[model samples]
Target: MTQKNTEDPSSQKNDSDCGCGGETGCRIEAVLSVDERGQMVLPKDVREKAGIRTGDKLALISWEKNGSICCLALMKADNLSCMVKDILGPLLNEQDRS
Candidate 1:
């Protein structure tokens, strides 16, 4: 049997607002189960809301705490690449001066 989460939604912080100082806060969008083929489907409404389409590529990112996996995140490949470049570009330039 599946157990339901009993946490209060209002007590949770919202991560959608990045400047809110809550980096780990997020709302549960949906609960999904993996199939025998190791595939899970994103809910229709969630997909639509996120503008995900059939041919879209996603980058799966896993977060580890204490050497164990704690969380998973997904972003479009294009966005992920842009984020990586934005974060690394300045650091790379600084290293070049050394």
Candidate 2:
């Protein structure tokens, strides 16, 4: 599935001329199955590269856009808030006015 954004950090290509010239920008497609207990196994390489651990905190986010549902995991607290604000800034301001 493809997603578009005006200017997205994750969407930036890993081209040789781009900021992330390494394979970090490469997207590895895989099928992840959620377990009966609502658990999914993140690939080992991905886990290591992301520095995710057994007890580390992760923010699970799901959203619908362009007629498709998308899910993502955020590892950092500040990043999670920034992402939420980016997606919900208008709504957040409206709520503040009440």
Query: lDDT per residue, candidate 2, 1-98, as tens digits?
Result: 78776796855654333232245564644568999999878889877888777777777655554556544534555577888889899898989999
Estimate candidate 2's alpha-carbon lDDT, on a 0 to 1 scale.
0.66
Q: lDDT tens string, model 1, 1-98? A: 99999999866766443332334576678999999999999999999988899999999988665676667878889899999999999999999999
Flag regions of model 1 displaced more than 4 Å: 1-23, 93-98
Where is model 1 poorest over a 10-residue stretch in terms of lDDT? 15-24
Q: For candidate 2, what is the total of clashing residue pairs?
A: 0
Clashing pairs in 1: none
Q: Give the lDDT of residue 18 in candidate 2.
A: 29
Best by lDDT: 1
Candidate 1: residue 56 lDDT (0-100): 96
The most accurate candidate by TM-score is: 1
lDDT of 2 at 61: 57
